[model samples]
Target: MITDPQGTVLALFLIFCRIGGCVMAMPGFSSARIPMQIRLFMAAALSLAILPVLWDTVYPTVHTSSATYIGFIFSELLIGLMYGMLARLYTLGLQFAASIIGMMIGYSQPGAADIFEDAPESSLSGFITFAGMMILFMMDFHHIVFRALVDSYTAMPFGGVMQMRATLISFTDTLSSTTYIMLRLCSPFLIYGLMFNVAIGFINKLAPQMPVYFISAPYLLLGGLFLFYFSVAALVSQFGQSFASVFIGR
Candidate 1:
């Protein structure tokens, strides 16, 4: 049964290279909190699991010369990285929206440690980001990502030349879609902040002697928090719903 143990091992490694590359860049899995050893083992396990299903495609590729094998390794890694980055970029758009929402709503306090990443973020931003990611997990976004990864073998195959132009286009398209979605999510806050500020500006002009900035700060925060409490469910729900279209539709 194990006649070509060397070939099998090579094929497994090739599969590992692709899956490992994906895990390396994937959002939740690639977090700084996750240990490298865990990531490695996870990738290896996935590679072994997928090898049986993809054996026909992968096994033949491994029988090639060393130079060609090296090329395949790079190609596989690039392909997987591209796929992982697609999901990662979409989640990153949520973070961008969080920052925008915080700024628009006057929640500009000093930044605190991010719940998922090592970076610092405002409390409001952190809340939004955390909530969005939680919703994604609840909706089992990883299942979609893994399904895409499995389908990629057929789309990309084992040893095709890496297409740099196509990869760049994919990245740009993901960014474009992500930006539009994030803007849509945060647009309410943008409008609210604008209207509130404009009204304040008129009031300030009328009562120049009053310390309007200091007086309006509390009202701004209160109204913003109240609006957030009422609308957060819809905001995050839309975020979760749009993930499929943004990541898969591309």
Candidate 2:
């Protein structure tokens, strides 16, 4: 049986390894603006908080060799990073869809205008990024994310087997699903872009001299924006469901 102090410290170290790795890549904690010291403290605090609950299962013989210890830490860090990146990738689908839709609508033009920030938006890409972030916060998706983080300990135990091949397959499938989701989410705008452009082509053939392309721009923008606004609620609902399914692995 392990002594209380040794087991406690070991568990804390392992948990913190995971937490630190995760915070380094996870979206909310991994923002470029957050100070490294703050992130380190937060990870340490989380590890400390969870140590008692995990102490029963986390005991492992300490490696005397420096190389072995480094290997263990690296493996644990890799596992944590994998989970964090998965979560971040899943959430990014919304932003990707928004960008695609905006681009199709011609709102993705570079330096056309600025919305939430001073940086110019190409076609409403900036707006999409901003809106996606807002929706994430407003929906309280972070709570689910925290829950997923806690559950990751159970799913992937400290010093667990790597299962690299399976992980690669799972990661690939997740990425594929993300791409499909983005395409499907933005399909309305794609269709609108196609039809609007086709109509413009016919008008150009008929008028020969008129600036049909310029005239078509307003209609495309209006149609795309109308579609986006009308579908925003449904799109968010779909995204929330998809997000939950992706992270919680339903």
Candidate 3:
């Protein structure tokens, strides 16, 4: 059994392992733009907050060897990483959807540049990725993530069985959901793209020298942008709802 200060410290370390791992892998908190000091501060704060509540359940005994302690730390880190990956995957869904939309609208240039980050995403892809991240912040999705972390202590107490398989299943399920939503989100663009291309094809067949491809470019872009602007609200709402449904297991 764990003793006074020994158990408390051990619990703190374990919880910090998971929290730190999450901070390292999550989006807003894990972004390269965020300072390391801020991330560490948040991790420390969260670990301190959870130490008391989880100590009795998760705290390993001080009598254990250093290797055992290391093992416990690894366990905590794994759990945190799993959760963090889920969040990151959700963010990627927006990028994937944007890529699809870009392709449909003839904007799927492979090497376009952007200022927000190092990635060289197409314009529409970049816009979608930026918008999704913004929506997460605007919707207070981070708070919900924190809440989930807190609740995790209850559902998956420290030192409890990690349920690795179940976690993997959850991760895969999130991936599938993300893919499905992304496809659905870009369905309108896909349809429009098909029709536009078919029409352009017919026109080209009639007047082979009319520069149809060149002229159609501007119309395609304007139409895609207009549709995206109108659909922004719906897209954000669907993502938030999907997030809750998956993370909260609803």
Q: Which residue pairs in model 3 clash with each other?
A: none
Please list the residue runs of candidate 1 whose C-alpha ends up more than 4 Å from where it truly belongs after superposition.
Answer: none
- Report how far residue 191 has shifted in candidate 1, in Å: 0.5
How would you encode candidate 2's per-residue C-alpha lDDT over 1-250 as one tens digit per residue? 5456754665578778877888787765676557889989988988778766766566553434556656667877887788778777875676578777877887746565544334454656655655665676677776776666677667766565767886787688778887887788788888888888888899899998998878878888888888888987777667766766666662
Instruction: Say which prediction, candidate 1 or candidate 3, comes out ahead on TM-score.
Output: 1
Candidate 1 accuracy as TM-score: 0.97
- Full-model lDDT for every candidate: 0.90, 0.72, 0.78
State the number of backbone clashes in model 3: 0
Tens digit per residue, CA lDDT, model 1, 196-227: 99999999999999999999989998999899
Sort by lDDT, top down from the best: 1, 3, 2
Worst 10 residues of 2 by lDDT: 112-121
Residue 208 local lDDT, model 3: 97
